[model samples]
Target: MDCDVLVVGAGAVGAVAALGLRRQGYRVRVLDAGQPMEAPTGEAIDPRVFALSPASIELLESLDLWPRLAPRAQGYAGMTVWDAVSGSDIRFRAAEFGLDGLGAIVENAALVSAAQAALDDVEFGAALAAVDETTDAVTVTTDDGRPVRARTLLLADGANSPGRQALGIAVSGRGYGGRAIVCHLRSERGHDVTAWQRFLPSGPVALLPLFDGRVSLVWSADDALADRLLALDDAAFSDAVTEATAGRLGALHTPTRRFAFPLRRQTAERFTTRRCVLLGDAAHVVHPLAGQGVNLGFDDLRALLVAMPDPDVGLRAAALRRYERARRADIAQMSQGIDGLDRLFSTANPAVSTVRGFGLHLADVVTPLKRRFAEVALGVKPGFPSASG
Candidate 1:
C-alpha cells in the first residue's frame, strides 16, 4: 500500500492528524494497533477527560466536529488554583480575556470518536513491525506481514513510539515520582462551571467540572501515598478526596473506580528523522498538572498543517525541516514551563513556597499579566494556525 502520508497510531491525535492532512488534499492512510473506539454504553462519562483549549476546539470545529461534541462537552468559564502548603490562591476568568469560556472538557473517547468519524478509513488492528526510510519514501512492514510505503510517515504512536524507536530516535525523561489518580465524583455543592486545582507538596489536585454536574478529579500523589490511596475502599477514597480539596465543593462522594498512572517528563531528542516525524506524546510528554498534554498534540497538528500547507510540497525536506523548526520552540517552552512548575511545586522548602505563593498573588492582582497568562494557556498566540493554514 502507498499514500501521500502514512499515519501510524490512530489515537485522538493521530486520527486528527490524518483527517487534517486529508482535508489538505493529502492521500492519507492510518495504521493502528488499538481496537476501534466503542460508542458509550450509557450517559456515564468516561473517567478520562481532556481540557481542550480554544485552539483545539477551533481545530475540531474546522472538521465540523465541535458541534457534535458541544452537547456533551462541559465548558469552564473560569479556573481557580491555590497552593495547599502556603494557602495562596490565583483565579483566572475567560471574561478577563474577552472570551466566553477558557476551554471545554471532553472525554478521550469522545474526541477519538469525533476525529475517527471524520476519517474515511483507519486500518485497525494493524500493528507496525518495522520501518525503513529510503531516500524517497518511508516503507513500513506490519506485524501481519504487509508492506506499506508513503512519502511521509507520521509517528503519533505516543510517548513510547515504536516508530520513533525504529528510526533510532532517543528520548530524555524523568519520573515526577508521583502517580495521578483520576475518577469522577459527585459534590455537595455545584462546581459553577469552574475548574479548580490545588498544589500540594506531593502534586496538584484538579477538580474539573462535567456537563452532568459531577466533577472529574485528578489527584497527583506521591507513589507511596498513591499506593495507600488506591488501596482504600470507594467510600474511603471519596472521603480522602473531599479532605484533599478542603471541602471547597462541599463533600465529594460516589467516586467511580479510580485510575492511576505514573507521571513523567519526557521529550524526544529530535522531532524528525528523514521522512518520519513525531507528533503528540511521541515527541513530548509533560507533567499533566496543566492538562495541556493533548492540547500540545493538537498544536503539533496545527503547526504541521501550517508549515506544510501544500501536500505535494509538504513531503519535501524543506517543508519537513520547516515543521520541525516551527514546533520545537513552542514545545520546548511548554516542556520547560511544565517541568519548572512541577519542580517548583514539589519543593518542600519554606522559602520557595512563600515566594511561589507571593508570585501567584501578584499575578492574580496584575490584570494585564493575568490576561497574558490566560491567553497563553488558552493556546491563542501570535502564530496560531488558521483553518486555511
Candidate 2:
C-alpha cells in the first residue's frame, strides 16, 4: 500500500486529520484539486469566518495549530440573541457557565494557512478520478492517471464533494432559498466582546466581534432581499445592516468587500462505505444560523479519532460503525433544530411569532435550561453517544 490512509482534500479538517493520523503512526497522504491556500495579506480580514467552539479549540491546540491562530482569534465572552418581531431577547455569558469565554471567531483563511503550514506535504492539483475499494484496501486514481493505494480513504472535501459522488454516496437536504451575506464592519460603539444575533422575517443577522475592534456580519436573507442588499453601495449596505440589527452596534460602516453564498442543509446517506469514509462537509452540511457547521465538522474528526484508536483496527467495519453511529444523532439533531429555528423566525404569522417570543424569554430566565444550552454550545455535553458506547 502506498500509505495507510489517503486524505482527499487539504482544507482545515483534512489537513488536521492527516496530521492527527500521522502522529498516530499511520502513513498518510493528502490530495487536493486546488492550489495551497495563501496567507491573509495586509490588515484586511477575510469575510469567511467561523465561530469555533471550545472543543474545537482544544482539538486545534492538541494539533499545535492554536498557537498560530491565537494572535488573530477573537474570543466573545457573551452572546445576545433576540427576535426582531417579538422584541424578545436571550443573553448568555461565559461566566455564567464558569468559563472565560464562549468561543473564538477566526478567519477561514487564517485557519487554512495555519493547518497547511503544519501539514508536511499535500498533492495539490490532484483530483480524485476514481475509487476502487476492496476487502483489504482502497485505491484511488487521480485525474492525472496516477494511482494511490491506502488502507482507508477519507473524503473531507466541501459539501459538493466530487469524491463523495464518485463513491455514489447520496446526500439529502433542501436549499433554503436564501443566501448568507458576510463582511466586516466598523461599529461606532464598541462590541464589548459580544456576539449579537437578531432573527428577522428575512432570516437571522449576526454581528460577531473581531479581534481588531471590527465586527463580522453574517446576514441571512431571502434570495430577493439578499440580491437587493448586495446591490447596495458600501454606505447603503452598512445602513441596511444597522437597520437589520436595530442599531445595536451603532452606526456601522463596511471596510471590506462583501460576499454571499447560498444556504443549504444536507447530510450524506451514510458516513462510511467499506474502506472509505466521509468527514467534515462531505458528510454533513447544516444551516449557519447557530454558527455550528464547522464546529460539527471538528466534532466528526474528534469522534473518528476516538472510534479508531488503533490504526490496524481503525478502518475496520466495526470501528467505522461506531464513528457513524456516534455522529449521526448529533448532526441530525443540530440540523433539524437550526432548520426549525429558520422556519419559525422567517414567518410573519402573529400567533407563531408570539409563541417563539415567549419561548425565547422562557429560555432566558430558566437558569438550568440556559446552562444546558451553553454546555451544548461549548461541546461539553454532546447530545450523542460516545465512541466506546
lDDT of each: 0.85, 0.85
lDDT (10s digit) by residue, model 1, range 12-51: 8999999888889998999999888854435678888999
Q: Give the clashing residue pairs of candidate 2, or none.
A: none
> After best superposition, candidate 1 residue 352: deviation in angstroms?
1.8
lDDT of 2 by residue, 194-294 (tens): 98999998899999999899999999998999999989999999999999999998999965898999899999999998788899999998878888878
Q: Which residue runs does candidate 1 get wrong by more than 4 Å?
A: 368-389
Per-residue error for 273 in candidate 2, Å, reads 0.4
**Candidate 1, poorest ten consecutive residues by summed lDDT:** 380-389
Go through the candidates in order and give the clash count of each: 0, 0
